[model samples]
Target: MLEQVSLFVHSMWELLVSKHSEGLYNSVCLAVLLVLPLLLLLLSVCLCCQGCCGRTCCCSSCRRQQHNRARRKKHDDLWISSQPQPIMMESLTLSV
Candidate 1:
């Protein structure tokens, strides 16, 4: 029984081989082989971007907030230093 099944499978393989060079079968096989590697590469790139980019993105946002806070502090200090003295202003007005 198994021998008969084997013979049938051999005949089927031979028929497929004879017809495979005709056109469409060869093209379909070629397309699948070519696209498989490209699909795998794209999947790896997506996973790497998700891992490496996510961590760096968080750190960058944190650093930006710290930088903005420091800039605001510097501006506030300069603004306070430039203001007029209250007693000097009153004495000047009385003198005038």
Candidate 2:
């Protein structure tokens, strides 16, 4: 099995490198050239989506901002709770 695998690999390498395989080599190169940019574009789009679509990315700034937002909310809640409430007043008509 190992010998068969090695023979296959050796034959493939020779085929790829031989002068008779120009068409095969051109096809392989064309495929790589065409696919590489698309793969890179996909990777960039996925990364951008992860960063922009309310998802956690591989950065500390978003985490820091999240913590800051939570802290601000907590502080605002405490401040609001501490404020005086308005008293309910009925009609105060003076009797003549």
Candidate 3:
């Protein structure tokens, strides 16, 4: 009867220890699975950040103002150099 008791106790102890070790291993695996993707995403952002926003020619407000001025100049030149001025048509269209 004592032997049986000892065996039962030993079997229960083994089962508890095995469950504890298995839980620890599973936690480690889950942590790695969750953390690996975040680490990879961070690494990708760090590597590609320069390519996205580093070398655009639109750097300053002054450059933008100059570009807008140039664009307006081109549009004005096309309109002004056309065959008829718009003012003449406006005067002809209305005679109240």
Q: How close is candidate 1 to the true structure, as a TM-score?
A: 0.37
* lDDT digits (tens) for residues 1-80 of candidate 3: 99999999999778666666889886677668769999999999987987786656576986887889999997777444
- Flag regions of model 1 displaced more than 4 Å: 1-21, 59-96
The lDDT per prediction is: 0.80, 0.78, 0.77
Q: Pick the winner on TM-score between candidates 1 and 3.
A: 1
Q: Tens digit of lDDT per residue, candidate 2, span 1-62? A: 99999999999768556634577677678668769999999999998988888574658888
Predicted structure with the largest lDDT when compared to the true one: 1
Per-residue lDDT tens digits for candidate 1, residues 12-93, read 7786676676789775886687699999999999999999886665577788988899999977775545667666665555
Global lDDT of model 2 = 0.78
Cα lDDT, model 3, residue 39:
100
Clashing pairs in 1: none
The most accurate candidate by TM-score is 1
**Deviation in angstroms for 46 in model 1?**
1.0
Predicted candidate 1, C-alpha RMSD: 13.5
| Structural similarity to truth (TM-score) of each candidate | 0.37, 0.35, 0.32
Q: Report model 3's TM-score to 2 decimal places.
A: 0.32
Overall local distance difference test of candidate 1: 0.80
Pairs clashing within candidate 2: none
